[model samples]
Target chain A: MEENTTTEKIFPPGSVGLVKSQDFHFAPGEVLELDCGRTLRDVTIRFETYGTLNADKSNVILVEHALTGDAHLAGYHTAADKKPGWWEEMVGPGKPFDTNKFFIICSNILGGCSGTTGPGSPDPDTGKPYHMDFPVITISDMVRAQKHLIDHLGIKKLLAVAGGSMGGMLAIQWPISYPDVVESCLAIATSSKISPQSIAFNWIGREAIMSDPTWNNGDYTEQPQKGLSIARMLAHVTYLSDQSMSRKFGRKLQTAEDYSFKFDMDFSVESYLNHQGTRFVERFDANSYLYITRAIDYFDVSDSADGDEHKVFEKVKCPFLVVSFSSDWLFPPYQAKELTRLLLENGNDVTYCDIKSHYGHDAFLLEYETLGKLVDNFLDNIYKEKEGK
Target chain B: MKIAHNPSDSEPILSRSDLVMIADMIPENAKVLDLGCGSGRLLRVLKARKNARIMGVELDQEKLIQCMERGVPVIQADLNEPLSLFADASYDYVILSRTLQAVKRPDLILQEMLRIGGKGIISIMNFGQLDARMQMLKGHMPVTKRLPLKWYDTPNIHPGMLSDFRDMCREKGIKILKELPVSQHRDFLRFLAPVCPNLFASNAIFVISK
Candidate 1:
């Protein structure tokens, strides 16, 4: 087992330690009926599990990852790895998710380009990448695929379905789609429906991707690096706030004392976004990005109820812990509050908080201490209540 | 459906005397919403003793965490802002204990409270109490055990006399369901509170309805 080191701790305390991702291939005859009226076969889900699933399988917490996040939620795949996981701060033996107490499972989302089967994966029938032929998947479709994975584990009900951002949308969808399968939900920095502003940003991102000649309409052998990078750069701006950007970069020039005056990434913020864009294209697929953002834009938890957001949650019985950040303009606190309001009006248990942070939508991943405590207490209480029953 | 006639010996230590009185006033299994619920002490008490389904609305970050720790459902929201998130008549009782005076507008808060809940329980610290009067006479601001913070540093921007609350209720057509005057932190002259609440009581709990 190799150790991942980001800081002084070569082997960090409270770490879940070295873990490996496992792929679950669906058996024949289990066709996934997608929301877009397409049938998907030979589905494969890449997942990682931490801790132990207790007797009766009641201690499981299904962690859904945000856009660009994969099955590597915590721990390290190799000792030479520089980073452990996306949410290593909140998932460890004694951390917020508390592997000592509850079994944690995180899977790469369906429309993802990680180890999971996605647009980048070879189509079973064609023996070639699905590319643009990949049927549009929704957040509910992702949850449905996860449900199959959960059933394959022989778990009847999850202790909680937890996630942030697009992951939060999955968390919100789980209980509504399969109320009996979820005990509770933790939705952080997400809205039940994508706002128009967010949809517009996604539009620009897709435009940037499709406009690239290398994209070849998602059929190129080589990845559309420039278009994907630009898309990632544009998407990254939405994840951060103006206050955060100002505080982090201000008007400081990157590696330059004097202004270039031309279009030469003079500002530190520009350089940072450029770096983010460059790094993203190396890991993510252009087609997967298109599919995932479209899935997010198409997500509306209230779609089944004639656009009545309140009525959509009529079948949901589980409690919710909805959290948003003070500076997150993308999925603002008011949107989370509106979701909470609808849940409350429908007579459901909902706990909410607009955490005071400058981290914007990314606060869900950064504000570990505050966010961790909230998650810890919520999961602890839910576990206790489950045990008592 | 079973109501506790008296508080159990196992009540949480965070519960104050005034909070206990407010908890006692709530019925069994009542859906209660506590506005400015500091650390959720009263909500916990109601949940334990009365089997109430309780939620809290608190603005303070630390208190919001405390509420989560205590397993009480809470929303981090400001009292001065429009509480339009909660629908009308969604709760059995809405509580603003010991926090009415600190709000920007007590009248609007009371109306909101009543709108969301069937009954609103407001505990207001009396600005016209004898101790406050004595302090005013001596030309110093009141700093009693109940109202310990200095005038300059206090959050009590809209502090008012007990009669002021009654007059506002009357003007707004809000009925005073019950009023319980109570002394806080070992005050000696507590017995005279109910007799002459405006002049004697350190603080009073008013159960009002529209």
Candidate 2:
């Protein structure tokens, strides 16, 4: 449990490399007691907030970050300074999630690399880093922790909750777990559950980590560089678009005019993969990545909650806006359409948009003009109805 | 939550300007039917401004409830479905708001609306606006605050403008009593929308007598 932080610092000062992004300073609260019947006793959570919490606490917008996300949603750190959060496009002044208007909160997830009570955090019972000893967490457990946070905030009902990709999964799950506490929901570039194809990719990534000798069956006090790097490489493949690779590489050479390639980063794509993997391992904990990926692998909200795939749609009793990018093969537009169709059939006010983008799964993060307008308009529609009152 | 504005004081309930011209076309104190009367805003104006006995048709239960809450009589009905339940010539004037673009068949609904009432009033979004034309040339469907949807996501089956609406009306053989186009926010374009209104207007409100 007590593995040292890092050696040969790859992240520049204030770089916000995969983990240890405390620059924004989302204070860690008490260890959350688990209801999962697992050995994980208590969990510490890092979280941040922006704007003033309204008197009635109705303007709270809970932002659930993605798989590789930290609590930093937007704004700079006042003290040990860092750049703004990943979603600077949508959370600033006059932006979609304008902090001036609503109370915005983001929390590092339970199994996340950022300062949450995850695999990297020391296990008090064993006096060591939790490592493999940390109990397996479900997406539902993450929602339960969020519920506790809301209770702590003394907020009865949230004005709205929004996110994209894995974060989007959490947004949809919130209404399911705590149906009464939400007024509106915005899910972007995500599905209600993980697809089989996604599960296969995640499983292969996990295999890559386990195959490396440095893993040492998850007991290595030292960094699992080989395993973690390989795992990152595999996961990186899923993130990039086919077209992006085609344009970037197109079967192109890396070093020389022709292939002198003998077990080196010969192809341009190979070099890109190596760069992504090495940089990822520099700040990320291998064990934590594994745990978080497993959580994603197991996340299928339609199961148990709704026995039938279509039934999941009818059960969601809220005004929702589901957005998906045409280029996002990770969670295609059809799933969002399915949710819309079922909601429409079940007499729920559901709005859907399939924006045309060539950016793939990362569109939610990169495509601002499209994602920003969709979010701004959605929040605007709800805000306008609240305006006269 | 704000006090419902006076109909005659120049604020139209649905927050559109062409409504003023369309409201003026409505016969005074005659039986009036308003289709897709969202929140009963325009019908309340008709009631207060012209002393018109109003019946509103809405698809969304929430909007229908809003109409009822406003003390306006409303019936929940879909435009694609039949509206022959009402007796023949039961209304002197039937009004259809900005819902023409969203319906399955604008032609069929208009015929029923005109058949039930001695005269019909139809106000639709005029897609022939110069801005939409500009959008067409840009290769990508230009999204604006007014028609804020991409080509892939718009709920409207057929979004038409001033000229297309009038041509369809003429083909249906419905006598045009008044054709008013509104482009500006409210008062500015209401007076100026006749010749060349088809180019600049956002909506065309037509009052047709059988």
Candidate 3:
């Protein structure tokens, strides 16, 4: 928990307070199947719930996290904590997710470094870290694990599923995985599949870690700080747009009156990227990063449906709100439009909005005012439609 | 469908007569696709009045937000692109109001409308009207109530006459199921609009089928 202190300070405080993360474990014989033709024994999921579940258990909203996000969605675990959850602006009492109105559930994915079962988790047989032994997982497998958690909580169906980036991928996979259970989906800044360019970036990140001498074949006693920092630095560049970088840092010197004439982080942008990388290495596990990025690389919803994206959406009965940002080159607006087109072709009720933001891929996380209103209006409409029925 | 009765003399925010006539053509519970639906006003009205399952396709980013704010299901897309996203004859009606003349290819859009919708309702501004003809006779482009811009600043790239649309529809084997001529004229002029729509009607709404 202390590892995330630096990253936590970047976000604002939440309206809700005193929330705690809870762990749910399955017995040894209970197996969770993996996409790589393997089985995970004795799975455990660490999740946080905000707001009370109604008697009918119908007010549940499952929030999926991105690659680096965890289950701490809105409130601080303690008053001493420096910052609130990652989506603090979106899940409080009066926020878009609205803890007062809907029950919010966010969980660390199966292949995560958080308090969930991942490469960092101990193997039951050997009583050691799973590391590379952890079976490769898919987006659908992640949704299935969430479904198990939901069923254990006695919730029949979820009111909505939402997330951005990798979380957004889960949001898309939820309805496809459990078509009958999700009433609505809000997917932002996500794609139906990982593009080759993104996969190439992920591969480079993995290479940076594996090529590090300290990595020691995924069983390093000490953290692979150098390799992990490089990976994170590369990722941070992708998360931001050229415009955002120009506006925020703009080749300004980092407190140096003159050019350093050396490669020692002279530029403000370089210093900022180094800071991001250093903080990320402190919180995230290197092996977990490799496994999760590999999982994302394998994610293709259309491939599961024999290359017909329209067929994949034909089973979806819920309303969808697909959002993209104007400057998000990582997962561009065209990808969101493709998903929307497939959904529309299947006659599913879908709304697509391309928000005009210079925040790039991170816009979904930062542009809460506009994104919150869109989600609020969409959810309100769904509620009204249900009431009218 | 939910018409607001304004007692004041202020001009209506929406085109009341056009929307009213279009709403009259749509049946209850029908699936409707509205192209270039600005602010989703017509779709909202249709949802309230006709109980239609309406969707809008708008290109402008700001208007798309407005549509979402009103809880209208809208996709931000250019109507100039092909409507291949929809299955053929999926919608009961596809309405293109005050948008055909501004599109890159109105004929292709109409064909798509008839392919994706069982019926197509198009509202067009008649450039061959008497006011436009009078302006042309005076050696200038028209700036009437329908075409409300100077020649160079107009968004209407292909300002077409009523007869031109009819001939195109006839050539494409699309049957004109119903024609409604709209005018803001006195008794005698209003009476003559139906007889010679291309010469008299300032605006026209046509319901067609393949």
TM-score of each: 0.96, 0.64, 0.92
Q: Which residue pairs does candidate 1 place in steric collision?
A: A2-A79, A3-A79
Residue-level lDDT of model 3, residues A204-298, one tens digit each, is 99999999999999997778999999999998899999999999998799989989888798899989989998999889999989988988998
- Shares of reference contacts reproduced by the candidates, in order, are 0.74, 0.00, 0.71
lDDT of 2 at A101: 84
Ten residues in a row with the worst lDDT in model 1 chain A? A1-10
Candidate 3, A102: how far from true, in Å? 0.5
lDDT of 2 at A145: 76
Candidate 2, TM-score vs. the true structure?
0.64
- For this target, which candidate reaches the highest lDDT against the unseen true structure? 1
Ordered by TM-score, highest first, the candidates read 1, 3, 2
Which 10-residue window in model 3 chain A sums to the lowest lDDT?
Answer: A5-14
**lDDT per residue as tens, model 3, B90-148:** 89999999889999998999999999899999989888988788899999989876667
lDDT of 1 by residue, A1-389 (tens): 55435543466788887899999999998989998899899999999999999888989999999989999999987667678899999999989999999899999999798888899899999999899999999999999999899989999988899999999999999999998889999999999999999999999999999999999989988889999999999889888988889999999999988998898999999999999999998899999999999999998888968888768988888889999999998899989998998898988878898888998888888999889989998998898888788
Clashing residue pairs for model 2: A1-A128, A1-A129, A2-A129, B126-B161, B127-B160, B127-B161
What proportion of true contacts does candidate 1 retain? Answer: 0.74
- DockQ values, each candidate: 0.79, 0.05, 0.61
lDDT of 2 by residue, B78-134 (tens): 678877435567778888878788888989888898778898888788776767778
User: How well docked is model 2, in DockQ terms?
Assistant: 0.05
